[model samples]
Target: MPSENQGFSVWGFIKGFGKLLIGFLLLLQGIIGLVVMLLIVGVIVSVSDNLAGGKAARVDVPKGAALLLNPQGVLVEQAEEVDPFEKALEEAYGVDEPDQVEARDIIRAIRKAKTDERVAGLVLDLGGLYAPASSASKLHDIAAAIEDFKTSEKPVIAVGDYYSQEQYLIASRADEILMHGFGNVVLYGYGSYEAYIKSLLEKLKVTSHIFRVGTFKSAVEPFMRDDMSPEAKEANLAYLSVLWREYAASVEKARALPQGSVQRYADEMPPLLEQANGDFAKLAQRYGLVDDLKSRPQQLAYLKEKFGADKDGKSFKHVALSRYLKAVGEAEPDGEAPNIALVTAAGVIVDGEAPAGVAAGGDTIAKLLKKAHDDENVKAVVFRVDSPGGSAFASEIIRERLLELKEAGKPVVVSMGSLAASGGYWISSPADEIWAAPTTITGSIGIFGLLTTFENTAAEIGVYVDGVGTSRLSPLIATGVGPLPEVAAELIQQSVEEGYERFLRVVSEGRGLERDYIDSIGQGRVWIGETAQGLKLVDKLGDLDAAVAAAAERAGLEEYDVVEMVEKLTPFQRIFGGAAARAMKLAGLDFAEARAHQSALRKLFAQIKGEIELLDSFNDPSGLYARCLSCELR
Candidate 1:
């Protein structure tokens, strides 16, 4: 016989234990059911979507009139149909991945537009489009193809509300440029804006110990100084100058404007607009910047009247890029003949193999270069580079391999994309020639590294560290531990100086500039293509098509097939790699599951783990590297 209080306690414990067990079992069953339902739904949705309407809709374009839409953002290598579940997950997570427009798709659209008998004219809508340089390079190629259409006596119309200097450069090649009735054009030019973190950290009572080698290595300056270093400033100016020259020249040739006229037109705009009574459209017409000033509806009406209306009253037979591409056959490699390899070096520079949606890995690119070099049928190589630079060693490895390709008798031409700066420029330096767009961001000849210390933070938190080491630099060598020793700092500075010297040497040798002359502009600097040409960093001011033409001329080929150097995944890779990707997505799902399964205790632990994983991934690199930490637009 138990007392009443003891009986009550025993009963409560039993009830609570039973409730937890039952809840656990119910939760497990619910998860199982949910997973099965999700799988079934996913399979059904995938099948239905694939089978809907039998196949993709196709559209036909008329000859001599082409519809051009500058679909710019992130470039997707392949555009796969979106899964409903993935879309839902993305929406729930507030993750808006950039929509991808494939290069091949754009090329196909241009080819179709050029051949279509109904397409008597083309319209380029250049508004709200900010693409990577590599993407712009491809766009420029497509524009050139459109120019070929113009040779057939068809006109290309370019329309923009407000034009950045680069946008104007692209539009300059159009047969007619159209500006809005109230739009303003501002060509303020280009400059580098690096974030300085030293002062920011100082305010937080945090210190950073920087270690790097490269005279132009300004990457670490943000951590140590409030402004750009002297070495960085010098290198940046020369590189930017070279970029600007390239840009201006490209625009000049494309627009058929005389020397200094582009600048003159830009400078005269304020007064020109004022003279037109503030009517931008009238002003543009007066300056020959535009042929017509019309509203969207008016333009559409004009187009309809010119090309005839569809049954729905829509002007002309306008085809979307995807449909047009489907109508035009994909470019296939000619197995019996030699091919010109177009290798794209886009995205961030990282060590090892790159995952999807990031810049390629050095090892991966090296392998591709080696393969292209080995292929005797690959008569010429066009390196399409659109990058902001990355690891110093990786850049050198790529540059060295490219030099080897050139040595092997392959005419290697570099086509600068939206960005070709720092390491990007380094790799391009060894090319036989470099082609850049007027607005292309190029030539950031700088380097940097950062190591943050948490000694003060630990002390403030009442934490202390005790360690024994054989060398004075041992403890300081680790990150977030303490300040670097003086000896270590000196060694790092010397290493940076040596790297800067080597950087200048490479540029000097490659660009035909003397060491002293190169050094004069060798500090870490940034430039647009127009500025770079003035400094002679770029050999030619043109787009990717121009680069291909140059390569063909160098290779002495009157007709050569353009073949992209893309790695074809093996069947095993398709199965295992896809499964791996699926697993990752599932892991993310599992994280959500764990949160839902347990109480706040489990959620906190999971979140901490996730943060650690992210940090670990960021720190997983080999050798010295300089990367823009905040720029992850794609």
Candidate 2:
């Protein structure tokens, strides 16, 4: 408004300020970059130093030394395989670096150590190893290996401050279990529990339209009702009873304790503690739960007398199970190794491609199977399943590939892990034969459709929807509107019913079981592997090695090398993707672990977020899911 002079002055001021702001921003970015680079460099140097020292130090196990089986944590089916650089980075941060042992390596080492005459006996410094029920079932092989070791007149001695239920299971198999002065065998029985949130949804004015075919399908009950339905409770009790009974029986058989000794100890703990004058360790020994009570020094002295100690007189000369695996290299296949492909199908079954840690996309797993089928060297395939289940369409995709392998004369066998229920079982149904561990969870052959609506919530804030659609189902599950029209809900229910029927048919055809019988067993009811055998859902009760042997037998091969089929990722891809993932975690974006202590509505929303993300991976446009929502057991 002023004049040419005023205009020039204003323009010069704006240009100068803009330049100054840009310079400040550039300086800030440079500082941030320098900080980040320094952090990376520091991490690298720290990791290199630790690794150098470790490599320089010698950890030698002398001959005739008892291998120390001091597992730090639970045994997973497989140990994580990280890229070298990423491993260094994670180790530098002290995150997820060799904290747990693999079941396969444990079994391998025990077997190789059984015959190694230098191995005098085994020392179990359990060190608070917490194995899950399913993991304990998988470690039956380790127990068997120990039994074989006993034939060599070598005792398996266990010494620990305390023993968890699973730890006691392993310790009970030991020739002698030595408990610390203050330690006791705390045996907590097994039970499945899940959170429900119907009241929260009601309070938030959100509605959940759950369509499921199984009468026992309690997966959606948590959303539709305020508490676990009577049917689900009954079903849960039945399975929990079986599992508990099995556990009690096994422990009793191993330790020769009286029937219900563990149960009695658990039930009468308070009074029993009073009876023992509050000495739990003495009570445990008096009750025959432990063989003896000794302090760490006393136990160490005993082990030193049994198995010679090192020159320092403190640490026993022992071979760690993990280190012993490297000592005795993998058994080499003789002559031309006939290939027996071991393809791992671990994690939730999504639709498309997914990464390594517990997200198995259907297309990705199918590709792995197809590759194994097409490979001339692969004479047999063992499909190892460790998922609780996910999308029905994805399960069908994986099952179809197994059928293709069958058509191509490639023997396909399924080896079930801790969990192989619902979608997990769907994929396993098409296998030539199914092998499951004793405590493997399987057979929840049901389908559910979950659709959330926010109609009431919107109306609570004076929001309304008045839109025209060409078709009735056109706006199905729209964001603002929810509780789809009755007709739409019926359509989704019909689809789920059809999927259930399809599941029954698949099991009927594959397992040679009758449809009615399969339906009787389906109904979203989980069963232990032994009950599954009774129901013909599983062929033999065993582990992965047994399944591979079955595959080899089916293929008529006496000598074959077990070839693991794993997805390969380049170092650059792994490093960048992992760094991004770590950044997301650091940014408080962890999706799997929903913060439970939040407000009820917040917790419900977090759960809903997880379900929505799961749905995003599903291939089915109609959202026909075979997920066992209540099947996760820690």
Candidate 3:
């Protein structure tokens, strides 16, 4: 009986070990299968991108062909292609990444289209196209280019499913504007809205001391007040008015109409549509806003009939902008070296070097600028700035490096994208020339910093913080304690004041404005491009192409090739990044959530240990430096 029991136990143990080994093998096989699948998908994507890249290869343009100008995405001062997976992940996680098409590229295309002998006309297609602020300026500039083409007796046509105010403004420049039968044109203006956080802070028992310089600098008003300050309202109105006027004038010039006629037409649209039995297309034609109402197939057929058929029986010689640009080539033998350096200062201004999406780090930008400056073939530099602004010291660091470029005799032109306000404007102030669209948000000349205390929260929780230091004011200083000492407060206030003055000095020098005038307009005031133009803050109301033209002109070159500066990640960097991403995915960790969780964990740990920490949290600095928290691009 004992021998039989021992045998049963040994068999049971053997069975258990065998099952464990089989389970382990299955798990390994599953992991290998997943990895192989990912590799296959990666290969497919790579091949697809390669094919898309090949679409830029040269194509012949037959005579009498109409150039199709389809611009998709934001117009940047430079175009860069990092790993698309990185870009996709960043978007998925709600992190900010700088992705834009260079303004110079847009302008170059327009110029080429205008001069191409085989191109008989131009087509402005507004389908699935979102013009970035810089692109808006480029569109206007391209409209002007089309007008220049018209001088040679060529025609320009614009077609769209619907026309927003911005699209209408650009299409107005076409010799003939065409709309879909069911399309609508809505002319809505711009507005700035602030977010109020006073009540939330109050509930949390956190006291915020807001000290700011500019009366028009309402960036900090949301925390202190519930609504827009009278000063902010007045400043925004002034700026918007100037911008609207400029927009109206540009549209008029492009359409070859009377000065006030476009405005009159736009204003009379609602009543005219009512009179036309509510047919939007009919009203558009009646007001001379559109020349015809047609479908895409019909438009294509009409072009085919007009231009004749090719040997392959394809009607008309249609040259896409991408293909046309490729044929023209991005380089020139006699033109300046195709070594164009594109430096992007996008997002908020931060202290250290980091990857795309977050604010432009001072260290990252400075290093890039230094590298570009050192490159002998980089004849000109295009500083593509799209930021709301951040740390005063960081902005200064970037601005200083830009100054170094100017000192080195390289022409620096700024291509302002959406929300180039406050610290954004500060860094851009040093550019040799600034280009902005009528709708571009820019020029917030202001300075601010925050110091928050949770004394009330600590008291409520029956937790007290005590400190001892060498200096009398040291113990009372830092975060999480009682109110700042009077001396320390005075010191910070003075520092802020000094920063404001320095900001004014930079603006005065950059814009060539007087100190008094800058002070009057400078108090952290945000302005649209038109008001900025009137205030002499921006050099021109134009886009990236204009900036590049200005830069080339400044360099005394009639034409130059544009080269985009991109940081090339090493092989090891790419390998490590892929490995890390795969590991995260395997662990079911969403990187963004992981980061937030880690931050919260650190904060909780610090609290539990009764430690005073200087947290570099994202905050809307009040007063002159306060930005529109809810004002994001649609």
Candidate 4:
């Protein structure tokens, strides 16, 4: 439509613009690359500085200073993994919130402070501490350490705005308990609760095919029923009641109250609050739960007067738990001492390799055991299990490795943490000795297989799957798109039954008991350590330290060094010190952010996301699980 000159001008402008756009894009890409390279170089320089001892700033512990035990996260055996670069960047931005603290670090700091002449007293600042229902064993272990610390006769004071049930357990060990004027000590005894979603799934036109052995195996109940089965309730209550009694009894003993005083306080909280005009701090004082009520400034003054003020004069002269650990350093083996390899098998068991603090990968754990077996200095191994179990196939992989260690004449001892049920018990059964804390939840021997399909939902959308196969199992290929074949379901159920029988046999052979006797107690029934010991499911009731000692004794080592074996990081991770782990908080970070301060809506969304992710993480090759969903306590 235009003239020849107009067309030529238009073509020239288009060519010029294209060339400019290309140049702009290339410049932008180069800038981005340069920025990335700069970040990497900065990280390298930081790491190099640290390696060359430039970052080795000494932590000084003042004479006559108090040891500040201010743990600021959920206590765990192992923490979740994180990316090293992201971790360092988060640290730089000062937004890193370590979600977990190791029980060993807390115990180590307390034991070290007990004999350190420079430390004058112990101060508990546990306002940010949270303990989940499963941390009963860990809590007791820490409480034991606190008790041992008091033998030095140094005054131990607990200061907090309020105390949670688990927080109160640790605080109860303090010689004097201090609270804010508006604070409350809320305690709800342990209970097991789960969301059953069968009706919801039916409404969504989805089917959940579940095959399980063990009448009490409620792991698949959420898919099969709208509510908990009566058998599950009976079994759960059996263990729940024992854990609650232990909690109350320990608190009562520590606080010097009557045997049932803790229970009475919790049950009568409403009336007690009414009597004190809803002032919880006053109610706590009346019940003798807390010794004094002090505002923040007043609490600071008390500590300063007792321990002597710091140079800044704003607080007492005290060494924080983390700083003091850095000052003293972790214990290292003195020349050629026999090593007791301590390996932690924590989190749900999955099949292949997984990083530490994630799932306990069968292959990953096997590698650690093999490493221990190959080490001439390592005389024995203590396998610490803290899991609710996961895949049956993965569990077998781990159990076989433990057997290999034993065959090599290396004694293997198992120390159960808060949880070691189902698949957890499967691997631990092969140990020379199994030790569990009095409150450790163990023994939910069960097997189950689950398959979910959405054929009905697909058909509702006018999508149909029709296929022909050469064999009866051919239709199984279209499982999620079409209805499952009857033959396939029957075969899966048979496999589950076989897995259960194998579980009973393994326990019988390992424990030297009859298979029938093991079956009687292996009906997916969960048990606390004290009860498990009585049933001969556990050899003794003890914590990790005791288990380590037992391992040492079994290995005939009069003097040995305890070495916690961990997976080696990759080159990139090692360059950044891989201090990216949740354990970094205990390792050296001096900052904390508590999850209790998160918005309720954010927490709800996070919980929902976690639930969806967990369901999606079922990666067993055979679709067979030896997990214990009912073992979780609330």
Candidate 5:
């Protein structure tokens, strides 16, 4: 074993040194962490005061600078709650997730920039924009604002390397759209696709027990079958077609093309591209979808010619949307003005508390409503819902709070976002008025329960779970490890049926419709906004602003300020957390693992993993869900 030929054992020396260094670093990290915690507690109060009065951190607007409309994140009704320390750590290691930009923030910026003398023009740098098919309403809202901005007689130019379907929707509103010479403009209409895991579960010797009501309630189909059921397909296609029609119509109207031009462009792409000798840019121009094609440098030169140059003369004089918002600051309400509290109930409905932009925790939303109920200044509430639904129990919890708010004599208006189905509809039922966009997906009024057991898999590995108990429900105790008993399964099915009846009753009472009629139209069917209005599911077809105005009108407030009600952070969390994270990074405590950028294959796998993870996150106490899995648009 002795290496006589290996004179210095260089490899062994390096290995030994690496181990020693790692051990030392681990020891040092623990000591440093302890000290940092103590130091944070000591500086909490002073840091809070400084942060409260800090004007140095604010960004300033340059005189006559163009407001660069460059949003770099997913457009959300409300941003998720982020821990500053965790965010800093992610940034320190360069693995932070994309930022969440609020739709309201973008609208506010556009509205403010419309009249601001310092803002001379608008630039659409939307190469990083990623709006989902479900966000058609929000996209239209932003595009409408851009149209309104044009009335101020300031130039609006959209320059990008390429434009995605959603990105092009906003770019179409600009006075000029410049794309890269080699860029392509493709438009893929709406679709709903999901992984079917029934065969995979069978191969793994796993059993999936699904309980559901409604012929169109296909949320559990991925476990029950390898393909979408006819009813599910019919319902999904109906809504998807509506959304696509709306999308094509909007783009056509904005670009001033014929009514069916956008549809023809998408439909005739192959032959059109062949005619253009495979030049996507030329084909786009030929079809009148874009203005001109230029490279990045040429685009920059063109912008500089329009808006003049910056002090350095490298590019145009403009302030990014993020920085521009910072300079403008948030608008505060006038003293004693009646307030219309806008509360966003986004994400899946879940029990207890949850971070913003995550699951819509029943308790968290209820707490927000409770605050609105307690505040005399808040005359009405505009509840924005963008969810595909989740836990039935959690939905009821939120619905009860809305009822309380209504009982308190405050008008509650529900503004449906991209999707407000199943449990999303449940919470909306209690509102005095429900507003939805023409493309909004809603009315999945159904309930389902699922339980996957590993009994067969355990048996395959020579393991078994068996026990004796006091009653027939004894086998249910080990349901995860043993076979589910017939008696227990029957009881669970009965519970699901009861839940469906309760959902029907809730809708009937909320909408002032007969229970029989509600169930006739219900049966877990999904409907688009326009169709839903005809079906009496929604009162009006409109956007969030319309809903806000309706809430004000109901409250009889001639002059009122719209206020976004959000969670407040503690003094310590707001200041010390970020500081501590930065300090730790500087101290060489680099514990974050480096994640490589995702490839196409990796993204596919991630989608599959997300579906499984979503199933795992179902934590309803009743084991019942009012979710619409088929509601997602592609």
Candidate 6:
């Protein structure tokens, strides 16, 4: 039935068959390569994770086990609480989750280990502890707990390849501090820096309209100016000096290295290195900053001799931080409980609710406070505040809610974290007692508002517009409006001054300081926790738990539960957010891997980009803001 031409085309038929065969072979090979790559990625990641975590559930601590206190990754107020399945998937796939250890968890673990008979001492492995200077003092409490152990002569050994300034604070408390032969003891004293975008804005012909009350309010500097203002420089220097002094004093006392050893070492690090022929290990020993220089195995040998080796004699028996936490369990208060509510106002103060990383939004925190207030079993509220400050109205809203808690007969105690400046200080004004760490950065009592218009930018691109309005200040603000209308600028400026006055009054009444005195120390000035306490901006120097204890005492409760008033992740976000992208990236299929990473980065950047969308955002239907832009220190 074939046509005559089709029957005669034998060579053409052979060529078609060969091409089909080649296409099929290529498709098969690609499928095989993909499967193999996936299998390899899975096997490697699964084995590593399973080996690390598969046995964690059943891990048992043997007798005389020392707690290995090595904190890796980021330390935050609270970690995102994930379900078991999500957590397992994350660990297995090596998904990027910022390693977070709660201060309470650390304290509780140390306290439990101190009491547990099987626990002998602590190994201060804080090499990976990335924390801000304000948090340095918070960790001091854990070191204090170790001191309790030291009274019993339990040897606390500190070991690390290198010690950052923050890590050295905790390390200084150890009985014996060891470093690697090549490791350096670095102490670049704390200083803050900012990026000026004014020139760029000018280049793009975008105009910024700024309103601020305090001379020391440097938040608007980046937009309007290139460098730090003289007043800002003076204020920043004063607080940074105070913080440095505190740091030096602590290290000097703990190391018994004389009055000014820490300062001297900092001032003459180059000379000291030269003297030791650039041998940092030698310099550390010569300066008494460290007791010895040893490699990992050598340090292991030292521990083995002191604590007695494990059954295999490979190393000393020790309980990891995670293992010890599980073995000893979280600190549950004794007796019938559920009385104290510990609410955290950690993160940048926003106008509305946000997830874990972003911290307290005004609405979210208000709801949380109300939630605590409504609970009949909740007797006292401990507000643990750590913020660089955001919305002025939002901070006031939070403070008003705290006032409500007081009106409802519930005592509200405030514990300041690393940063509680501007709006941070505003919200804490009404607290029954405000406790801050010696290293806590607080008190940037100021108000500022920023707006941008791009009329000039549009003009540069050959666009022009003229508009008519019913009122002189109609559409007071807009993206294409050049040099914000005079009437609108005056209004914003007036609001900022009033907001500042209100802030002054709040601090004046709540802190029991004179209006003039508060003003003298305020004007957007930051203070070290120690200096703040001296200035009467803080009641006492203590940790979050201490604040909780004060709250419990004020409520007259001998035995109470400390419930966390923190954000809870949604079910969908928990199951599919972090773990799914993590799984695909770990699979190494190269399928949208870049996109997967972009998703994670987007989560972090999206929050920041959305932050400055509108000056009205700071105005928030209220007026200007009391945000502390300089409160954050990198």
For all candidates in order, the CA lDDT equals 0.66, 0.79, 0.69, 0.87, 0.87, 0.79
lDDT of 2 by residue, 130-155 (tens): 66654546656667667777787788
In the range 125-240, model 6's lDDT, one tens digit per residue, is 89877886656556666667777777776778999998988888888989999999999888878787878888999999998888887778898999988888888888888888
Q: Give the residue spans of candidate 3 off by over 4 A.
A: 1-65, 75-102, 132-136, 195-209, 262-270, 308-317, 332-347, 354-359, 376-387, 406-420, 431-442, 450-495, 508-517, 527-564, 568-579, 582-634
List TM-score per model, in order. 0.73, 0.84, 0.73, 0.91, 0.91, 0.82
Task: Please give, for residues 175-258, the per-residue lDDT of candidate 5 as tens digits.
Answer: 898999899899878788878999999999899988889999988898988998898899989998998898898888888898
Q: Where is model 1 poorest over a 10-residue stretch in terms of lDDT? A: 625-634
Positional deviation of 162 in candidate 4, in angstroms? 0.4
Off by over 4 Å in 6: 1-59, 82-97, 309-315, 333-338, 475-483, 512-516, 567-573, 576-623
- Of the two candidates 5 and 6, the one with more favorable lDDT, higher being better, is 5
Model 1 lDDT per residue over 430-471, tens place:
888889877566765655555567777767777666677788
TM-score, prediction 3: 0.73
Pick the winner on lDDT between candidates 2 and 5: 5
Q: What value of lDDT does candidate 4 attain over all alpha carbons?
A: 0.87
The window of 10 residues in a row where model 4 has the poorest summed lDDT is: 588-597
User: What overall lDDT, based on C-alpha atoms, would model 5 receive against the true structure?
Assistant: 0.87
lDDT of 1 at 620: 22
Displacement of residue 157 (Cα, Å) in model 4 is: 0.7
Error of 6 at 196 (Å): 3.1
Worst 10 residues of 5 by lDDT: 591-600
Task: Please list the Cα RMSD from the true structure of every candidate, rounded to 1 decimal place.
Answer: 7.0, 5.1, 7.5, 4.7, 5.5, 7.3
